[model samples]
Structure formats: C-alpha cells, structure tokens
Target: MKVNYTGFQASEVSPYLEVHQALKAADHRNGKPDVLAYTSVARMNPYQALLYRSFPDHGFAVAPLLKPFELRDLMLHKSRASSITLHLHWVNWVLAGEPDAQRAQTKVSGILGRIDRFKQLGGKLVWTAHNVYPHDAAHLEAELALQQGIADRSDVIHTMAASTTAALAEYTNVDAQKVLVAPHPHYRGAYEDVTSRAEARAVLGIDDDETVFLVFGALKEYKGLLRTLEAFDQLLDQDPSGRYRLLVAGGADDHPDVQEFISRGLLHDRVLMEPSKIPGSKAQYFLRAADAGLVTYTRSLNSGAALLYQSFGLPVLATDTPVLRETLPPHTALFLDANAAVDEYAAQLKALRALARSTTQTDVLDGIAHLDPSAVSSTFAQDLRSRLGLRQH
Candidate 1:
C-alpha cells in the first residue's frame, strides 16, 4: 500500500526516527517493499541529520505535501495514496481555539469536507491516540467535536496503553472495536554515543553521593513542575542533610504559571534548572546523571518519558494514574498520588530515593526487558499489515 505518514516532526523531541528505524528493519527482514513517506514542514536540513544517518538505506523520504490550514488541498492531492496515518499534528491545530468563533467553524468545516472527499477517493484514515486529548488544547468543546468526527471517520485507532481505551471512548466516543492496543516502542540504542553515568554526573557538576531526581523533556503547565518542586523542597527540609537534588531540565513554555515559578527565584544551585531544548547528542547527560527519573504529570494518558527513563536504566517515580499504572508495572516504577499532600509526596520521594540506591543494575535491566525495540517493531509491522489487509509474502 502507498502509505503517507503525517504529524511526524523530524526533530530530536519526536520518537518518529526510532519508530521508522524499527519498522524499516522489520520490513527488510520480512522482505516487504511498502512505500512509506513522511510529511514534514520543509525539506531536509541539518536538523534532520541524525534521522538521515540512522536510516540511510531505508526506503523513506521527506515529502512536503501537507501544510498548516491547507488540509483540504493536501488531502485531495494525497488521496492517490492508499492510506494516511495521522500521527499527532493536524488535529491539534484544527481543534485549537481562535478569537473568532466563525473563523474557527469555517476551518473545521473545510477540514471535515476534505476528510469526506478523501474517503470518497477510497483512502483509509488511521489515527494514533498519543493522548486522549491535546495536552495544550485551548478550546475543549471544539476539540472534542473534532475528535468525535475523526474517530467516526477513522478506519483504525491505535493507543499505546490499553487502559486508555476506555478513556479514548469516553472522550471521543470512538467505537471500541476499532481501537487497537499497541504498546509504545522502547527507545533502546536510539541515541548515539551516550556518556557513562559517572562521566555525565561529573560534567553536570552533580555530586556522586547526591540522589538526583530528573524532570526532563519540555516543561509545560500540565507536567506538574510546581508540584514536583514543592515535593522536592519538602523532601530537602525533611532530610536536612542535602542528600537529594531536583533537576528540572527542558525547554520552558511561555505560560504564566511556569514564568511565575521562574520569576520567584525558585531555581537555585540545589534546584537546578536547564531551561533550554536538549539536543539528542546531549540528552543522555540529563538521563544518565540522575539516580531516578521523575514524571510528575498532573494529567496524562501515556508517558514516553517513563519509557525513556526505563530504557536508560533509571528507575521511574511517576504520578499515580490508571494509564501509568497499566503501562508501568510496580517493579518498574513507584507511583505517587497526584492529589496527595506535599508531605506525602515528599515521603514517597524519600522512599524512592532509598529504593534507587538499593536497586541493582541487573534488576533495572530485568524491569525494562519488555520494552525491547525489535519485538515492539515486529508486532507493530504485523499489526499494520493485518489492519491494512496486506498479504504476507
């Protein structure tokens, strides 16, 4: 089938490069020559050097067919392809709030009209539910309407966590039968030339004895950054010996809540903050320097960060949510109640810190064994073929 993959940012933040590598490797082993192309905002540049290097011989190319607010024309052009796998991009914009309600309605109308036209051309629509809803959705009602529309039209819906199936149905009213539970692939061996934990810590100026709790990735309001800081502060006060340090590393959002936290002088020598985009080459420093990774998401259905932490052999301390509980086993991660008091969270952090110190490398490896990328890719390829009705060679 001629498949066009959309919503993939060919940047360091996205997991598309890893996913593409795994899928391509699977295809090579299976001797399948499926034509796969990705839609990007622009042509290849230095920013996509890592992705290009990884998949040099893989039959993947960047096709600049889609642009923002041009869904109708793009879909009409891409209708020649057998299918379009919508990842996580266009829907967010379509559902985003505009100051003029009429203008927003017009845009939605145009998108829906194009979707119908694409269907008329016998093109299949697939959506991967990366989140139950957009993390930064401004117009909830409009976004829901668009979600429901997409769910109604989609031939297949993919979700990383099985627990999110019910939430997906609840939010988008998608038919449960159409949903497929595919675990998010592990990012093993994705980053190149990773530095050792000791060396990374030395570069970051972190002490050998201090237990580091890292809150990595883009810093957003819903990531529970303030709550994490509060819990870490309490832990420091309770310990009094300065045994733990909180490292908040990631690009900061323009939201007032995050700005307010920064303006209050909350960041200091102990509470280290690296408010910048972490490149792929330097990502391992943050991941390796830490004793444990902190995923303090106030609200989320799935966490790529938790998987990343496990991939890097760091025990995870994540917020207690059904999706997280289902995705990460008790042995892999220790869960904290999102609604718990600061003291309670601090106590949990302390316990996790102790656990991290006691946990062995073998135990960490065993915990993350299920996230093997080869196995994940094989399953993903088989599922895709089955869903698309492609005959096995």
Candidate 2:
C-alpha cells in the first residue's frame, strides 16, 4: 500500500518527521505497507530536499500543486499510482493565534478545494487535527465553522490529544465514531545516549557551579514565559546570592514585553537568552546541563518541548495544567498554579530552587528511557495497519 503524507516535506527537522520516520520503520519491519510521502516541488528544489535526493529514505514524492501549470502537463502524462491513501495534516498558518475572517474563509476554502480534488482522484482522506486555530475568544466562531467544514469532508479525523479530539467533535458536531486518537511520535535524538553532566555543561558554555533553569523553544504567549519570569523574580528574592541562571535557547520573533521585562532588571543576569535556534545535538547538551526544565505554558494540548526535556533526563517545573501533567510524571515534576500572584510565584520559586538542590540524586534517567523511538514506531505501525485494514506480523 502506498500512503502519501501531504503537507510539509519530510527532510526538515520537525515533529511531523518524527511521526513519519516511526511509521516508516514500523511498516518496513512488519511488512505492513509501502509508504510514499508526497511533498511539494518547492520543498524538492535543488535549494531544498533535492540536495538530499540521493538519500532514498528521505521520502520525496513530488507534489503536483507546486509545479508550474505547463510543467504539470508532464506529471499528468506520466503513469500515476492509482491506489494511494492521502493523509493531509490540517495545517493552515495562524489558525490558532488570531483568526481573521478573511484568512479563515480563504484557508477553509483552500482546504476544502484540495479535499474535493483528492476525492475526485479517488484518494482516501485522513485529516489530522493538529490544532483548531485561533485559540482566543475572537476566533472561536470562525474556527468552529472551519472545523465543521473539514469534519464533513474528512473520512477520518485524527487527534494526538484527547482535548483536541473533544474540541473537534464539539466544533464540527462530528460523531464520536469518526474521531481517531493516536499517539504522536516520540523524539529520537543523540541526546538520549549522553554520558556526564560535566560534558553536557562544557558544550553549552556554563560553569559547573551554576544551577541552570532551561526554557527551550520559541517564545510564544501561552507558553507562560511571563509567568515563569515573575516566578523567577520571586525566587531571586528568597535567594539573593543564588548561582541559578536561566538558559533560554530559541529564536526570538519581536517579543516586546519579554524584552521590556529583561531591561527593567526584573530578570537581570538570571536570564541568559540564546536568541538563535540551536540544532538538535546542542539542544540536548543544554537540557542535560540544566538543574530543571521550565514549561509554564498557560494553554496547551501537548508539548514537544516537554518531551525533549524528559528525553534528556531533565525534570521539569511546569504550570499546573492538564497537558503538562499528562505528559510528565507528577512525582518527577514541580507544578504551580498558572494564575498565581507574585507572592505565590516567589514561594513556588523558592521551593523549586530548594527542591532542585535536594533532588539532584533522583534517577530520572530510567524514566526518559521509556520514550523509545523503536517502541513508538512499533505502536504507530500497528495503529496505522489496524486503521487501514492491513495485516501486520
């Protein structure tokens, strides 16, 4: 069976690749299906995945849409595979942040148009609902309407989180039978096999004495960076001479409030910003060197950041939220109320600082070992096989 994954190419470093790789390996081992991941011409250009075209496992099936209209004539004349399942990852930019009516209408229309075309071509459709988009109050109506349209046309609606599944059902008025809950792929990285804390610290340029609090990934509003900073301020008050420093490794995209807070001395030298994207290897080093990983996301269905932290054997201090709790073990993580006042934040911070010192000996390594890529691959292969009605050994 040839399964073509639509939206975003597989070569780039993304969570989607993790999923694709897992499924691919599982399918190969179990003899479940032959996967042909479809991607756009733009992604396959010499400037992109084409550079890696020699690598057969990269999964670069040329997508017809991105080609020039005249050039598409060539693709049309070629022998096309008729029996293929089209899995479209529901990806419309800005669907979750601030929903503009015009954009929402356009995005929905575009998605529906694509779905209609795939249907006409006799392709089985699976729309994975990664997000409903426009997470705020303003976009609620528009998002619901768009979701309804998607649900009506989609043969199967996929969701990684139960909360996301429920939202889809409620917004689309889709029957519970149509929604399929599946585990998103676990991260596979070189960081999993790392040795010592000293080596990890040396790689990231931090002293052995510093108690590092790591906040990884791009700064987003709901990620709770503001709350974490406020909490850090409180933490500092309790331990004025503390050696703890925050290492924030991510690309910054014009976060004015975060800058203002830094300038106002609220964060001071405690906040160390690496205002660039660190590649996969270095990211692992930073996490391993940290005393505790911080994730204060206010509203989240799931987090890849939390998984990365756990993969590197670093415990997390997250906000008291369902998503974080579900992803991490309660005993291994520290949680504080998302709406805590400054005083409350300070107390929690103080406690967290102390806890980090006392619990340094805790064996979190064993816990991280469970999120294995091979295990995740096997699980995903079995699920996809079951859904597609294919026999697997």
Q: What is the C-alpha lDDT of each candidate?
A: 0.65, 0.55
Candidate 2 root-mean-square deviation in Å: 7.4
User: Which pairs clash inside model 2?
Assistant: 95-133, 95-134, 96-133, 96-134
Tens digits of per-residue lDDT, candidate 2, 9-71, equal: 333333334334534343243233333233223321122232222212322222322221121
Write one digit per residue (lDDT tens) for candidate 1, span 1-393.
Answer: 874343334344233343334344433443433423323332222222222232213322223234434333334324233333333223676655576666666766777777777567654565667677778877666676777777788777777777777767568787877776767655667665458989988998888999999888888988877777777778888887957888777778899878765554254557767787887788788888888898877777788788777778788888888888887767757988878788888988988887788886567767767756556545655665567564443
lDDT of 2 at 306: 68
Global fold similarity of model 2 (TM-score): 0.72
Task: Please list all clashing residue pairs in model 1, or write none if there are none.
Answer: none
